[model samples]
Target: MNESELIARYFAPLAGPAGLGLIDDAACLIPPPGCDLVLTADALVAGRHFFAEDPPDAIAAKTLGVNLSDLAAKGAEPLGYLLSLALPPDWTERFLDEFSRGLGEAAAAAGVALLGGDTVATSGPLTLSITALGAVPHGAMIRRSGARAGDLIYVTGTIGDAALGLSLRRREIAGGALPAWAKTLDAAELIDRYLRPRPRLALTPALRACARAAMDVSDGLIGDVRALMRASGVAAQLDLARLPLSAPARAALAADPALLESVVTGGDDYEIVCAVAPERAALFEQLADAAGVAVTRIGAAAAQESVLGPDGAARRFARDRFSHV
Candidate 1:
């Protein structure tokens, strides 16, 4: 099918009232009273972001999910998004079917709709970009520069699973050599995390109410935390032992303890990391708990410009995260 037919058949149904049924050249948005619009964009490229052979649905989900993650960190409610999909010349209709299905499912789950988008044929790899729009109460959007000294640093959900999953998918780690406990590790689960990251939208309200500063962990916890600290002009002391890990990740680490660096430094986690005031930490935790999302306090802001380890000593790594350049 051509671009117009492709969108009319697969994407039109996913548009919201503001989307103009995917027919208009532009979309409309009207923020609620006493609210400000929040905007974020993310792009995914084949082979670089995901395997060229990864499922179309997963690619669709990741393309939008990463953008949603940004809104979540800013404590904003998702409204809609604009997509720019670049399809290779040889892509099949079946691929479009599955890709649009995945995008629709993810958009529905997040309560977001497609506002408008452009579709084009490309000579290189399949490339997808999305600009997501959300809203928060005026002056209430969380920021990466609002953290203060003595504020507690917290992260939602576990870290590093997606990075590990990428290693497995790339055959960097031999599946046959995995330990017994790690052998039973659900490969699908790990791969799913890598492909379809969960944006912490459910925690937005708590973040808006209690977080001093916030940003989603897209490029490894360590690097992203360091960026947050730099943005806030503060230092941090993180207890490596307190870094939350999933059962599969724990088993993988037990078999190869050296993977710790990759766990903390590899990217694509898509979880929220925020700083909360000491007095408000309790209420933040309570609200997060009520939302049924796990939140862990792993560190606190400091006056210096370094990141310290569990040993209370400054630490440095070869590389803190993935760099596009």
Candidate 2:
């Protein structure tokens, strides 16, 4: 079908009044009184972001969830999102149907409406981008520069699950043989973590109430921590032992300790990492418990550079981060 027919049949229903039924060339948004607008955008490309055979629903979830993760880290509530989709010449109706359904369901669950965007045909790979809009109280948006000396570094959810999950997924995608350790771990769970990223939106309340600085862990945890610390103009020492790891991750690490480096540097984890003043620790924990999200105290931010390992001094790590050049 053509873009107009596709929009009217599959996407128009997803739009809010601000989108003007996608009939208008532009979207109009009015933020809540006394609130500031928060905007974030992310893109996903075929083969790079997800396997071609992966479920359309999972792709939609991750495409939008990654953007929402940024808003959550900033302690903002999603207002709406603009979606741009580029489909290859041979794109199928089934893919479009499933993808739109997944995207609609995710937007509804997040209380975000669809704004107007462009849809076009592409000769290259299928691609999608979302520019999400959120609202936070004026001057209250969390940033990566507010942390102070002596602040405790805290992270939401387990680290390295998505990274390990991605590795497991690669093996499956390439039809490679799984190693002995792979048989012992929860492969399904790890793959799910990689495919469906859970943005820590529930923890925003506590974060806004207590966190000094915040950012999402889309990159490796160690790398993200370093980024946050650099932004705050402070050095930090993370306790490798205190990193919260999922059962599968722990089992994988136990089988081969070398996987520890991959776990630390492999990206794709959408969890939130933040700095909390020592005095606000109790309140933060209380709020997190109320929200049903587990948070772990990983380390402290100060003017130092001595990380501690599980059994001794910090173990030397290779490539603390991964990035696309």
Q: Which candidate is the best by TM-score?
A: 2
lDDT of 1 at 174: 38
Instruction: After the best TM-score superposition of candidate 2, give how far the Cα of residue 103 lies from its true spot, in angstroms.
Output: 0.8
**Pairs that clash in candidate 2:** none
**Which candidate comes out best when scored by lDDT?**
2
Per-prediction TM-score: 0.95, 0.97
Q: Residues 265-320, candidate 1, lDDT per residue (tens digit)?
A: 99999999999999999999999999998999999999865555545666677898
Global lDDT scores for all candidate models: 0.88, 0.89
Q: How close is candidate 2 to the true structure, as a TM-score?
A: 0.97
Tens-digit lDDT string for candidate 2 (61-111): 899999999999999999999999998887888987898898898888888
Question: Candidate 2: worst 10 consecutive residues by lDDT?
Answer: 305-314
- lDDT of prediction 1: 0.88
